[model samples]
Target: MGASLLPFQVVDYFKPGIFPLMFLTGPLLYLYVGSLTIEDFQLKPIHLLHLIPFMLVAIHRSTIQVVPISSSPDLVENPQYLFNKVYYTLLIISAFSYWFLGLQLIIKHRKKMPLYFSNYTGKNSLNWLIFVLSLFLIVFLASFFSFFVNNILGLAPVSYTTLPLNLTVFTFIMVYFGINQSAIYSREKVHSKLRHQQLSPEESLPKSGGALLSDEQIAALSALVKNYLTDKKPYRNPDYNLQMMADDLAISRHKLSHVINSGQKKNFYKFINQFRVEEAKAMLADPSFNHYSVLGIATECGFNAKTSFNRIFKEETGLTPTEFKQTLERSTN
Candidate 1:
């Protein structure tokens, strides 16, 4: 919409009333990212304030375009030039500001993933969002630089030509990620609330004189975690996580995370999914379980999604589930 207002003869038929619609991009992008990270995110009445700048810009442009001016040929030839300069400047600032905010939100969401989720694969990891926001910041910076060079310096008008291409690339990137990226918090709502309830004031307090675990204690806790998983098969529970394991072991979530990170040298998801992949392999290889399909075996082995099962299976073992099953069949035959 903002592009249509550029000083191009082909877009002359395009009206200039809604030129400020470009301002919506920043707030809308922020809102979209917020909705993805925050479960049940609602539009508060306060959020309507974001649209005020757009409304003011739109009103100014509408008045300028409608009001007759006899003296200035600049106004007659290109009335939108001044507006475009201001709009593009604001656009760049808005884009960068919101992109930074979105990036921070994704970082926070990623840090919180281990607290609420078992499998941090795919959408739950939020790497896609980070990448998108990073790319958006880069594009916005380029746009701002281009606008500054063309409109302010007046050295090379061709610099402004790249703005449309930059926007097009941005659009394609957003659409591609939008279609492929799954929801980060789709399955984490209940767990998130539960985790909030589990938090204690002591946990948040500074440990002034709290005893630190010795190396031996860490090793023992790691061994116990491994043994518990092997004997009890808690990984077979789809909802199993560090917090759940900590509760079962009668330890704090922080200690369990420390043991997994320092002793096991893996995150909670990797450690748990490793066991799940092993279980899936065993299920796939067993002739007695031949009645189960690949997805059935995945579900039976505590994988919520077949894609995750396949991805993790391949990551752990070089072969996919089907290939592993085929190899097993050949060896048996």
Candidate 2:
């Protein structure tokens, strides 16, 4: 990006073969997102394979810059021109492909988050990164079109300033979010914790658990979970999560997630939020709770944030918590 910001004469003099380094754009992005969003991410020899494209293209461009190994006078008939055309097209395809794959990684990782996380937080949500990627993709597409017009068609006007301008805006956005966005997982702590707790692409089933749950076992575990939730009302705790409930129930987190998903027909987050919403509904109607404000009622009902509580409440009942309370008030008056 810095290279593109400089004057052509300066860039060519100082960094002639920087075009080939463009191949690194996609690989580096995918590597960054993958490390954050996925489990078991580590520096491995296999990861170096992503660099091969960059290395090959860089070497080819460097040879041509120094030695001018091949050249043709005819514009269309030139082999070098044809290969360069294919090169630019492939660079665009490669970068876009990695961007799309990074999007998929974020999505898949997010779906699994609700299985363990009962409430949303920055750490649990990558929607901001998704927004970032969408902007990057748009900028990238625009820049590619600009490249095709100015350099490929030998037209001078459109592509000259737009490419750098797009990069400059995108750089600012990346910096802004990079500074503001919280880390999804700390590598040192999360890697070790994931290995112990085991939240991978694989199903959240048991490893040491041996045999799969029989229908009878599933029913028994399901009953146990339901009975405990009803009797103890652990869902009333604002910070409660699958792990906490799992520990209280003397079940592994994996088995707890599996039971809730299979038996209750909801992810852990939705399953717990359902209970909280029901509790809020009861309190909304009960005169004894009328003294509490909606947020106070929500806090007592296990919601850490009023926004989450209201959203979840509306999802469960067609009315917001305030609206629900007003409905009860109107009926009484």
Error of 1 at 40 (Å): 3.1
Q: What does candidate 1's lDDT look like per residue over 213-252, in tens digits?
A: 5676777778777877887787777766665666666667
lDDT of 2 by residue, 1-333 (tens): 565544553324533356566687788878878877876688789989999888877666655633111223234555455546556777878889999999989888887788877777764577778888998888778878777665456456332446556656766876777777655543332211112232322233234355556555567678877877876787887656776776566566677788788888999999999988988999989999879998999989888899999999999999999998898899989
* Per-prediction TM-score: 0.57, 0.74
In order, the Cα lDDT scores of the candidates are: 0.70, 0.71
lDDT of 1 at 247: 62
